[model samples]
Target: MKTLTLAATAILLTAGFASAQTVRIGTEGAYPPYNMINDAGEVDGYERELGDELCKRAELDCTWVKNDWDSIIPNLVSGNYDAIMAGMAINEERQKVIQFTQNYVPPQASAYAAMSADADVEGGVVAAQTGTIQASHVAETGATLVEFATPDETLAAVRNGEADAVFADKEYLVPHVEESNGELVWIGEDIALDEGIGVGLRQSDTELKDKFDAAIASMKEDGSLNEMIGKWFGEGAPLFE
Candidate 1:
């Protein structure tokens, strides 16, 4: 996308932060078009590209580290990684535990997918990834919320009749439904929650947070961030701009 100006690159180099030399970005490598393990067994996808660009613009040596979605935050708190670029949403509850860079991706619609078009979306068993906004929403609907550690498991639960439907980010579920042909179909209205998606850093790492925030801001200003979103999520995908 956008190339860093010489002046901006020089400023990042002179920022004098130790973490600037080797920042490890943690992510759930199971989410496609966001983050995924490629055939070569390495982290690959949208966040991979976006994270690399941010690191380059900030002049930081960086690498990717894969972690399960459920324990991603805990691992970051425990110093397993320096930052999270895992398509994590920014909300008040998460903000209580860690700091976030300004949102790089805008809030997206969450939806439900089921084996049949008439499947019950309310007051029925529902599957969702543990520790996610969709899980919380399903719980509040008086539905039996079956929590899974991963997104794929939620879809499996529905396919196997363990749950009537799966609630998740619409983008993440779209491909699964397409691949399933007519076996799976989207049901119910779209749910919108959280402000947007952002990079997460420990509360104590203000310098690292600032560095990434500036990098994200620069991408937004140069239209590179929107370009990346379109490339990965399709032309009609929502953008930060």
Candidate 2:
């Protein structure tokens, strides 16, 4: 009986070791609706659901890892994680550093929010999450750009009068505006940029990228992706299809 127990233990250990090699899905857990740390302190939200489905379809064992938004791309390149599904937009500049799966979410409108309806969106001081496309856009425009390490900080900056306006994804800003009662208001036209959101992978991880791409394509064809989008972002949300 002792010998039989030892053999079973060895097998179990081997299986556990293999399972530890799960593909790591990196994300910024701070971004709500897209991705966030739930009450249980695990990664949850739209990207969480979407990414899990893609991994299942691809037949890949996966796990989630949280990282700061500013270092997301760099950490992916450094092999800290196998892929990035943290609501990242696919753009030319990012493509130069790493490959991207086909966009799972379509191009989204970037918008500005301010404390007052008459705030100078184009010429006033604007706050944006550091290292994001919105920050880049603000830097190029006539507005003065103040960058924060996290999304919450950018919104806080506008609320505290450090910035006249805050620029970010329209969808992300919506909840804040709604919760603010009359304190916050959407201002300025939507700024459209990039192709869409996709999973970021290292340049050499074409196999992994292809798997995710195929999974995303499958979700689009079957309408499950669209359903998930609506479930998280409302029925009027933009979808890949």
Candidate 3:
């Protein structure tokens, strides 16, 4: 039975190896300024735009797949995808589960204070996404955390007073506030998460990981990365700076 099991594992491994060249990218098509699904059901946003740019630089044929935000990292680890490009912030906790490319995009955090006292959020109070830097700080500061799946929900939570404040990437939330009818302020202070956004891969796939790093370096040197960032994020954005 052990012999049989080993043989089956070998066959599966061989198949995985054979098809590894074409990198599969996973994302949540609902996180705007990172990844979002358009009305046409196509993924678009800064991360999506960056993914295409990386593929071009690496000369790799890439295929992008959209999944829920909560499932992206799990799917990548399960081999459902070769990498993750969901505007994910690379922190030490996540590093235990997967490897990440060099910081392609610097990390930026934004905080939004509530404009009302009657807003309704889960648990009727808190700030920032759970497990995020803001949440950690709130926890330490003895404040409650009202977690949400998307920035829209987070911002809405603040507007309605369900949350005392909301925190996330400025690039993601600033545009949202600008377009909203509410009066959310930047607070002029950001919580630096000490993380950078990067492509995620299996911890053992050094070769593939190196390719992504090389591609990113090339893109930066050739100004393609800057151009892509400017195109997606606009000039003088804090995330880009």
Candidate 4:
């Protein structure tokens, strides 16, 4: 819904840093284990905790901004925020418009959820959040894709039989399926979408990006990053090693 250019992005980043301003990090507060609005109506989740640590390590003054997922990248490009840490996987398509720091979270699986175990996610009507890798994957496959503005809407479509299944990140869908008490179940094996999750920044903010990248690299080297990933995603969660 929003668009951005490299020149505009660079100018914004340069001006903000000149005065030692707070670097605003953008996230979709609706995706859990990554980002969500807590009971206090503030951003919380793995990204929140990880972002705070990353900022602390980089010694940068930073803040968080919640934005709609579809507009997250456009807003970042348009200078609504200085970075993105909303469980975004690093991929070639996204790399074309914006730059990314090294990945923080390892590549995770995507899966399908439905009321029936045999639901045809491969060919039947499937729902996915708009502007996500799942939506793009569904569109490219034989399944008829139904796009929703949010993840909850996609699950609701499946629960109500409006869709055969909902395709999304396995991490996000895991709790929902477990809570369904047999009402919903995984329909297929895991689907791998991108390389890993990373911080999204404007191409011009090379200096800022380097700071976060170095922090992320340090965490990886010390195993603190994997510990954080396991803590949030469960002990069985994937690790760099």
User: Best candidate, lDDT-wise?
Assistant: 1
On TM-score, the stronger of 1 and 3 is 1
lDDT of 1 at 41: 98
Best by TM-score: 1
lDDT of 2: 0.86
Assess the local accuracy of residue 215 in candidate 2 as a C-alpha lDDT between 0 and 100: 69
Model 2 root mean square deviation, Cα atoms: 9.7
Q: Please state the error at residue 40 of candidate 1 in Å.
A: 0.6
Relative to the true structure, how large is the alpha-carbon lDDT of every model? 0.88, 0.86, 0.69, 0.86
- For candidate 1, the 10 contiguous residues with the lowest summed lDDT are 1-10
Clashing pairs in 1: none
Candidate 2 lDDT, tens digit per residue, 32-62? 8999999999999999999888877666789
Tens digits of per-residue lDDT, candidate 4, 140-217, equal 999999999999999999988889999999989988988888999888689899988999999999988867776677
| Model 2 residue 185 distance off true place after TM-score fit, in angstroms | 0.7
lDDT of 3 at 29: 81
lDDT of 3: 0.69
Q: Please write out the lDDT profile of model 1 over residues 80-127, one tens digit for every residue.
A: 999998888898889999999888888888999999898888888999
Query: Candidate 3: deviation at residue 89, Å?
Result: 1.1
Can you give the lDDT of residue 53 in candidate 3?
Answer: 71
Clashing pairs in 4: none
> Can you write out model 3's per-residue Cα lDDT over 41-128, one digit (the tens) per residue?
8988888778887776555678889877667777888989899898778888789999998867766664544554343323346667
Q: Provide the lDDT at 71 for model 1.
A: 95
Candidate 4 segments whose C-alpha is farther than 4 A from its true place: 1-21
